[model samples]
Target: MNKRVGNQTVRLESKPRIISTATIVGPKEGEGPLRDYFDTILQDDLNGEDSYEKAEKSLLYSVITAAIKKANLKEQDINYLFSGDLLNQIISSNYAARDVDIPFIGLYGACSTMAESLGLASMIVDGGFANHAVASTSSHFSSAERQFRAPLEMGSQRPPCAQWTVTGSGAAVVGTEGNFPYVTYVTNGKVKDYGIKDANNMGAAMAPAAVDTIKQHFMDTGRTPDDYDLIATGDLGKIGRKITAELIKDYGYNMDNIYIDCGEEIYDAEKQGVNAGGSGCGCSAVVACGYIYKNLLSGNIKKALLISTGALMSPTASYQGESIPGIAHAVAIEFGGDKNE
Candidate 1:
């Protein structure tokens, strides 16, 4: 016999699973823009002429290993590793994985790395290919900025909604059989874009993507907005969340009590001085791995959807006058049942 709990459906013979997550910072705590882990590692001459690729390699290597340790999993026990980053050819992930003795598969979805990883990881377990897997992504502001835009010290004043690329790495371990929480459902997002000119206001640019995914999830699953206890978007900050709500309502969906944005929840809006919210691959990854996973395990929140939204445009693409492309992928995670007992 099978039973359903909130959004999670478990088969009688099926096993419950959980994702253990961890994060590593380049910069110490209480630092301003470019003062955090990403910038410190990138700008510091500690490596003595280390290239951008080298800096990324060093940072990701430490973080992934630390995350594995925190999860208390051995390298051989991990079936596969799915990782991505904003570097060319995913050098950071590749180089880092080399030190570990696990099989590796690289993935790229721009800022949607975490969602892409979770979606794929869920499929691996649900399809019975592998019982255990790990998903990770990383970004460093100094390296990303230098590669995408100008040098770090350019003193460029960003727009109100611009998000700082998190200088951190996060990882999660998922098992098909355990007392761990299971990923119940996932909806892959299609690329959507609004003609927003400036890259600074990412929330406005990504608003349409978030709205489309949320609407599509409801339609495809025959689920209503009220069906979910909490509808959380990955990194859509204040502006994007508001826009997303309005657009969903326009499409005849009301999500008043259930809607929240991960970006806004990660940090204090007033203290962080972020008018809108956080953005970047790490934004969703860290919050999910750190906060959401903890709460779910502790039974604080029963059912939730993690919709990670990404703006899939590079500086070159934007400079060539290309319209920004966006994507949002949703993964439903839930807790509570006989398995917990």
Candidate 2:
């Protein structure tokens, strides 16, 4: 049993399952087409919290507990909690983890935390080191604006290329056994920076990383787009998705029939006027843990590849004239695959 599958991808032999999931979104996301997929939709971003950052922590903690409850497990029963967020030092996940007694592994993968955490959890569970692990992440628009650009109170004018950061959180329970979607393979993406400097145009910055990881996943797994029902990117929005599609197509992956991005699907791009679309750690989190998870549970989608994309840059790096770097982590989940695989 060596589970390693080539350089970047790892095949899981133990079959870790998604026992349960929970998602909470703000009013803007709640108004989207997939509203019913979420477990809770807040009327406002703060929900009486003093600040958007605190609201973000509240969202993460709430979702973690909700997912645990849905799985019929106690907090102490969770062996480990994998979590992350966009705020400085990942304060949202740090503070949220404090309220729970489970061991925590805080991550900072920008928007890719959801998939990153899930892949890691699956690895540990598949290795027989843990029976149950929880993976979760969150993001807030107002808080992101304050940290990345200007506060919303400044009434900043955003360019058409700018995307709206999602204000939401998503949590999921991964365990050794369940009649849920099985985590079969994990592809770790390399950091790919194309000298992008603009903080607003994250899609352009992260598209190359997405393409690189996706192309490698196919190469390593010996599978193509036709092998899976869908390939979903965590965020990437419209601009990034197009860039990824065009680039990966150069490698012979015609994904037009099976590809979609969570960012583009979360908002009504035409009616909402969100410009490019949505981008945030929560953008893909809520969609994957909610919509996609539910769809998998219902057997509507037999196999899916969730590649959560991230822009690995900060306000400090941007101010210092450093170019933005991007990364993407892909996790392959399927239903009723070969029993021994």
Candidate 3:
């Protein structure tokens, strides 16, 4: 009954299975290296919606539906829905869940919402609280830009360090019974700030938090980087990824063998115009729900550690010159290791 594994880690005895997953991405992301993994690719970022917010909501709804459909469940069959977005008051998730009959739990962890929601969903099912639950998140370049930086129409020149916001959404269906990829452990993170003020440089602000949570995960699990076929940070992009890789080395861990950032993996830095890489809540969501999930099913990766990072800063806080704080949550998932009994 006691699932606490360490100061920050929880070992889920039930090992809730990831029943199904779905990913939808914008044209830019669809053009990236992991294009084949995504379920739907929009020719236009708006997805026929007049506003980016509406498009993001649509993306969230579509992916959540797709995941559930893949699991052969209807909305009435789902016990709980955990979702969020970067929009103000998380309107994308709130409005999308507006029509669903399932109990809704809105989350807010910036770009880390995907992992935050997924971790909680897995726990709920693992604790016998639900038979089936859903976790999802979404983000859009236009919506995020207008809120966090400048309006897209203004065409403001962004600095080289700025990463592109991923216009996409991802969802996963978690169930108590299945032989699919299982959620074994979750390591929650602490908020960290290093006096970084520029919103454009989120990777730098968030790198320390990624490093801290990952280091804590290793310490708690007694597992090295080699234990996982892949160790992915949510959206540290190039700068944050480099910083995390270097800082983690100081903790006596060598992650170079299998470590990668979802941001960098989402886009081709050489061919894409995206300055550093991709960011936003959708970055890790789509990557994990699409590429990683498929690989797990294919037996290409028996184990994976997904660490989603977030820069906890509001426009008002940033305007007041408050330094950005970062947070990360790591979920340990494995296939062919355990089955629901």
Top lDDT prediction, candidate number:
3
Better of 1 and 3 by TM-score: 3
Where model 1 places Cα greater than 4 Å from the true spot, the runs are 1-16, 26-56, 337-341
lDDT of 1: 0.70
Question: What are the clashing pairs of model 2?
Answer: none
Q: For each candidate in the order shown, give its overall lDDT on alpha carbons.
A: 0.70, 0.92, 0.93
lDDT of 1 by residue, 189-282 (tens): 7888778867777777788888887777777666777666678887778888888888999888999898887677655667666566666676
Clashes of each: 4, 0, 0
Error of 3 at 286 (Å): 0.2
Cα displacement (angstroms), candidate 3, residue 93, comes to 0.4
Candidate 2: residue 154 lDDT (0-100): 90
The per-residue C-alpha lDDT of model 3 at residue 95 equals: 91
Worst 10 residues of 2 by lDDT: 332-341
